[model samples]
Target: MKNTLPIALSNRHVHLSEEHIKILFGEGHELNKTKDLSQPGQYACEEKIDVVGPKNTLKGVRVLGPARKNTQIEVSLADGFTLGVVPPVRDSGDLAGSPGAKLVGPKGEVQITEGIIAAARHIHMHTADAEDFGVNDKDRVKVRVGGERGLIFENVLVRVHPEYALEMHVDVDEGNAAGVKNGDMVELIK
Candidate 1:
């Protein structure tokens, strides 16, 4: 039997810190949960902000909640082109030398030193799921998708944690290239 996981297409979004949230939204303002994400405790916020790059400004970018330790901006490769930024492809939270941009909210705006990135494709597996697949944390694997645009994605990272649900996340560029959508099952190529 082949091990498979559901695919989730991630679009351009921003994760804000508590301080940044207060600065962007308002003092003591809280994010309103619009929808729950596949990952536990993650949700879409009702608020949206604008991302100003050197070349152009991306308006009304959705914000994800709850606030994180540091604000991170995840954008698709196409978004990078639109913003005139060459965001490095990095794993989420691994934004050391990536690009930065100005984030504008209703109340205020923030200039991030370095946080923008084109997130790498990865699978989020629970410990039990990892055991079932015989994979470990931070393992690199390949996934094969079936369809007219079927292709094998290489160097896909595997993230294992107790709280993580079994799902594969891909940026819009990858998803469009593979012709895959949310809820589509992709086989793990060991």
Candidate 2:
């Protein structure tokens, strides 16, 4: 039988408001805004940057929405960098006791506001794919991602719908830790 499992890298991300963006990036730093259909009061940034987390460094994170009282930064896999570990996506306000970050530019040093690490893990599967896997929305299970950096991820929440294809979602920190990338294979580890 053919093994449908493949290793896929995952990344973490968070939502922030314009005001919080100013607090984090400082004044004059640009914040791009894009609407998100999946979440209300959610948005995506056209510009991307690097965010350092507790265990690893995350590159190409697109900030979403305007800064709110409780804004968050989303960290995703580098798509190419391999640190052999996934860095968790953290809230800016929660980075105080966690790792700090430096904006990759002439901007010099940037301070993290929060210290929370480890975003929730979830899987993305289409309605048909979900049926194929015999899983449903909110179903929790373990996924075995195979490759040089193979790993069995547990407690993965399932999100099933028509708009989604079969895929697992992870924050950048988690992706880095697990060494995941796009087109990587992931199998239900049950």
Candidate 3:
């Protein structure tokens, strides 16, 4: 049986470590929530920063919080080209031997050693939804999106957690190519 899941298009953004947050913002600055994201306990902060790459700089890049163990930058392939960095497609929090960039905050700037990545397209499903979809955590599957720009995306990672809401996350390039928008339903083909 095939299952359909809602899609969420993720833009280029950074998740900062607490130390980096203090350095970039201030000694005791907390990320002010701009809005709650689909994921549990995650949000877009009011703060924005500029990320400088080898060939270009990306301005107004939103910061997503609460803080991560290590800082990581997620971008699409098109975004990678714009920044002149060939980012590896990695799952979130998997930043061993990735690329790096300079992050410019309003108060300070810091150089990240290695964290930039093209986040892998994945589906976050709670236990109940996982059971419904007949999948488990870390299972790889294919997804079919129907439209004028319809396509079948392979190796879509399945992330299962009780706290995670059911949503498929893809970068801007993937979404645009598939003609998908937020709230669009995509089918999971085993």
lDDT of 3 by residue, 36-136 (tens): 99999999999998999999999999999999999999999888898889999999999999889999998899999899999999999999999999999
Instruction: List model 1 lDDT by residue over 1-190, tens digit each.
Output: 3389899999999999999999999999999999999999999999999999999999999999999998999999899999989999999999898989999999999999899999999999999999999999999999999999999999999999999999999999999999998999999988
Q: Which tens-of-lDDT digit does each residue in 1-190 have in candidate 2?
A: 2224433443445455454455556667776666553333446667555655444556666665555565444444342133223335432344435323443322333554542245457766677777777778878889877667778888877777777655566665566667777666667854
In candidate 1 the C-alpha lDDT for residue 144 amounts to 94
Where does candidate 2 stray beyond 4 Å? 1-13, 18-44, 48-61, 65-70, 75-117
lDDT of each: 0.94, 0.55, 0.94
Point out the worst 10-residue segment of candidate 1 by lDDT.
1-10
Alpha-carbon RMSD, each predicted model:
0.8, 6.9, 0.9
Which of 2 and 3 is ahead in TM-score? 3
